[model samples]
Target: MTATRVILIRHGRTTWNASARFQGQTDVPLDDVGVGQAQRTADALYQELVGTDVRILSSDLSRAAQTARALATKLHVEVGLDERLREISAGEWEGLTRDEIVKGWGDDYDAWRRGDVELRLGGNGETRNEAAERCASAIVEAEKAMDSGTLVCVGHGGALRGAIFSLLGTPAWPWHAMEGLRNAHWAELQYTGQGWRLSRYNVN
Candidate 1:
């Protein structure tokens, strides 16, 4: 048996998110609204996935793990942790806002925002391609552990988006066509035997 589907879910929002600050690999927990979102999302997912073979995986970060725990509790399954699912490391820019980053690294930030895949974020962070590759690898690893079941991967926005870009084999850098996932939103990908097909994206 092989995994036929993948559900990529972004963790709930944090105070940092509300402030437009970069959380990159930070262990920030979910805010109250985020907790509510997680519960609602878990309820919806439970309804959709009940009686189906499901496996829940999550980033080791607190925010993502917390969100994953909600779903896991609903499904009565243990959440598996994968460090590779962590958000793109922003290094010096971890807690800074976009404006702050732009103020400090104006040229580089501009290039990064323009979808320059080669730019190392925060002067010492992971490149877009690098993050994408690692995320893709983590997804594959999760798939290998499952057999013909829907694999739910809970993670940060940037890393999960990078996973989608890599898994879909998109040639375009930065994948401007794909928007970021809202807090607690999810994207679904199906394996058509021939290749992976996006069944749904940014679904709440």
Candidate 2:
């Protein structure tokens, strides 16, 4: 079987990110600093990913899509936007800060961090398991669609990390064992006979 190589990138910073807002699937745009980050990381990734059959896929949200566009342009390819790659919906938590969450939903937040995958943080929000499933499904289907190539998937922090956890065959209890990605940083993985293996994490 052809190896399914993947470069999983976290989208660049948005105004919400800088402001420490929840963001979620609120469709925030990248900020000025984020634009520079995208360009710089695109240059770096273009060099790193050269000579591969590259296909770019991004979350339909503006922040992620913008990041994908920058990197895809550098690689001379059009970005494929997919709504499934979007951030987990925060529902009522959207636009709130971490401190705000702590103040308002302290017990709920703590319980969630303590491995309550079924606990929904906000009204009409997704559980951790649900978010992981959506993220993982997108990657799995996309991998099946491509015979061979590097799949550069750009998405938000929460959703991207959820996908990683799901792909690793780990339970949500150990979620914090894997740290979240910095803006524009990427993790590289390859599907092989042995299954998916993480080659590196947080490479810029």
Number of the top-ranking candidate, with TM-score as the measure: 1
After superposing candidate 2, which stretches have Cα over 4 Å from the reference? none
Q: What TM-score fits each model?
A: 0.97, 0.94
lDDT (0-100) at residue 39 of candidate 2?
A: 87
Q: What is the clash count of model 1?
A: 0
Candidate 2 displacement at residue 124 in angstroms: 1.4
Model 1 alpha-carbon drift over 4 Å, by segment: 171-174
- Count of clashes, each model: 0, 0
How much lDDT does each candidate structure score? 0.89, 0.84
Report how far residue 31 has shifted in candidate 2, in Å: 0.4
What TM-score number comes out for model 2?
0.94
